[model samples]
Target chain A: MVSSPATARSFARQEGGAGLRDSVWGARELLVALVARNLRMRYQRSALGFLWVLLNPVLTTLIMVGVFRYVLHIPVDQYWGFLISGYFAWIFIVHSVTESAGTIREHSYMARTLAFPADVLVISTLMSRILEFVLEIILVASLLAVFRHGGVPAAFALLPLAVALLVGMALALAYPIAAASVFFKDVEFALPVGFTLLGYLSPVFYPLALVPEAWRDLYSLNPMVGLLGIFHAILYDGRVPPFSLFAISAVEVTILLVIGRQLFRWKRSLFAEIV
Target chain B: MSSDVPRIECVGVTKRFYHYEHRTTTLQEFVFRQLAGKPLHVRTPTFHLEGFDLTVRTGESVALVGANGSGKSTALRLIAGIYPPTTGSIVTRGRLVAVIELGTTFQPELTGIENVELYAAALGMRRREVQASLSSILDFAGVDEFAEVPLKYYSSGMRSRLAFSIALGSDPEILLLDEVLAVGDVSFRAKCYDRLAAYAANGGTMVVVSHDMDSLPMLCTRAVWLEGGRSRLDGSVDAVVQAYLQSVTSSS
Candidate 1:
């Protein structure tokens, strides 16, 4: 249908905006298709093919658990279980953060050609990592069962909320990183180092108790302290996180997600030019 | 403001792109530039097209004919909504699709059929629509025999033909076709032109970017001649074509 000239003059932005709003329903299917395509292409043409999915986490866990349990003697109880939970959470964060920054830079062509919301790309990046993360979870579960270290905690009902918060945290951090990278290529370098330092600061490989008495509270101020602590609680200790700590992490992540979304919308328009 | 809306209206449009004097794409160079306190090496903004005005009414078939670097392709892309004009405004209604740089979404590792879905989806068709039309698309391209083979194994012509076939299935209200008619065979090229004529006859607006003067008159009711980032002339196809021919021959 032909629109009047006044409305027609504003067509580029407004019409595309309406098309985006109308197609919010399509976002889910598009994201699923993108995730499927990425996963397929990732392992495509390799001789081993889909075996890499199972072998990757298994190998990483084996090497790290062997090193810490035998080589270093870190002195944590049930170190195998601890590393499984810790590494699971750590890998998701690291993989998602490092790759998310380049998501826009990588799919710059699609963003220019298709008028879909740019957030779909960022969310799909997270979804692809989440799919791989799901595989890691399966490996962890089977290994935990095999070793007699795995059991559902009493607070298992809350596990879904905890997982949601972790996803929220990744999305919060990833949105800004991907959106801003279009303006400044420097994000490409800063994010990997930042996430690496974050890995060391969090109690991923080591126990949280290793932190000294005076600094433990200050260190808990790092949001991941509470976030990963919940993962530890559910998977390792069979206990619920302290309600106060859990609330703090959830609130922190919600705030970051809100701000990151704003920054993303502001930056989305300029992407076609710089990308 | 009129009651009738043109399919596309680009008024006082100017697009300026940064011309980097140095290769500063790396982080090390960025840091060194900051440490040394030198000016950023983007020398200046060069206008790809400046103060260009165009209006394509509904059901209009327009041709942008220009020599290399004359901004015809840029104008086509602007109308296609590939990117916004750096300055001024463009208003377009309907589902716009630009077939410029086909096979951008083609993954070499993907099979021919897979790339068909991926490229069509990238052009704004839903996955279901792409699937529904996949057989017909393949049938027309005559790549049905190798649909399961990886695109990397296909010759360049095969790849383009597949991409072109998929693009044809993308239901666009306003189609932006850049000089992509060079299919693998002459029959397919004829098929493409026939489809083009049918689409235009059915009142589908189009902005065709090509330098071929012979084909220009056949496809366009109106022709625009562009030179040095300006709309040098726009008139009926025969008049503008003749004028453009005279100018090129007289000047050279």
Candidate 2:
């Protein structure tokens, strides 16, 4: 129906304000479809196809675990399990952020012609990483059963909570990078290095306890460290993370997400020009 | 005219873009001094739109005819809410779908059907709504057979046809056409004109941005002639098109 002229004029900003909210709710289907298409297209042309999904972490874990466990004499039972849980979670974060930072550049075609929230592109990037993580979880579960000679742990009940935490964290982290990368092309170039440094500093492969006592307290301030701790608690320790770590993870994720979302929303209108 | 409301109101709506003087070579230059804190700089940035004004009522199709750099697309971007005006105010009601730069919007890796869902949804159609519209859209584009194929594989003609079909099918209250019809095949072009004609007959507001004189009268009732970021003429399509054509012919 034709919206009256006056409404159209004022609606530019009002509808824009509402449109920003509606874009989140309205674009859900497009988001799912984009992610699914990428998943299928990525593997369809590969010779090894879906096998790479299982082999990637397995091979990485084998190399790391063997080196640290045999050569470095790190305790395999606690430490290997610790490394596995934290590293995979870290991989998901790094992969999602790095891939999503260039989402607008990669999908310039859609951005130029269509009017939609750019967040959907960022979501698609996160979605693919989530798919990979789900596969990693399945592989890790099977390995745990095979190696430990035990069925899945009871902490598996916390899977939903872990996923919720991951999604919130991804949203908080990815949008600002994704949104800004449009104008700042260097963001894409800079993310990989930043992620690698983050992996080393965030206790992805090493235990947080290895840090000097003085620094350990400050390093826990890295939000990913807390998130990784949560993952280790549920998967390796077979329990919920401490309330302190959980609270830190939640607060940091919430703050980053709110800030990232505001920045993204503020920048969204200008994207068509700069991009 | 309704005493209370104009369907669209641009009270001195203006837009100015910052153009960089030189492409910075290194990350240091690109980031720290050059890129970080400036939207406008005196070294090279030029402000284009001093004050652009226009208003449209419901069911009014206003063609914004201009030369290449006359800011037609910029105006449409402002109206679509894709880009906020750098200055002044713009108010618009209803859903606005801009069919500018067709085929430039689909994700290269996505299949035709997938791109259709994404593009249509971007226009604010719900998933169920797009699914309902999908068959008709594909049929209209005549690319139904290639529905599952990746968009990167589609020919330019096929892509434009599909893009146009989606844009037209969305039933936008205000449709912005930015020379999208100029690229498709002859028959496809004819079909687009026919569809646009029908859409206009149904009282859908439209704004066409084009340099094509022949096509203007066929699609528009009123036209605005733009030159060097200024409106040179605004009147019936025939008068403006004739005036533009005479000026161009004389200049050549």
Candidate No. with top DockQ: 2
Candidate 2: where is the Cα deviation over 4 Å? A1-11, A14-22, A44-47, A76-78, A149-151, B1-5, B23-27, B30-42
The parts of candidate 1 lying over 4 Å away from their true place are A1-11, A14-29, A43-47, A108-115, A142-151, A180-191, B1-3, B22-24, B27-41
- The docking category that best describes candidate 2 is acceptable
lDDT of 2 by residue, A152-262 (tens): 777767766776787788778889888878877677778888887877888777777778899987887788878888887777776767788777778888999999999
In model 2, the Cα lDDT at residue A136 comes to 83
Evaluated against the true structure, the overall lDDT of model 2 is 0.75
Of the true interface contacts, the fraction found in model 1 is: 0.21
Q: Write the per-residue lDDT of candidate 1 for residues B1-252, one digit (tens) a residue.
A: 232678788887776666777646556677789899976475666777888899888678899887888888777767766656666688777777778776666778888887777676656677788889999998878889999999899888788788878777776777887886566777878887887788888887889887778887777899888988889999998898899889889999
lDDT of 1 by residue, A95-198 (tens): 88778778888988776655566787788778777767766766665565556444554655566677788889999988888887887778888877888898
Native-to-model Cα distance after best TM-score fit, residue B189 in candidate 1, in Å: 0.8
State the local distance difference test value for candidate 1: 0.76
Calculate DockQ per candidate and list them: 0.29, 0.34
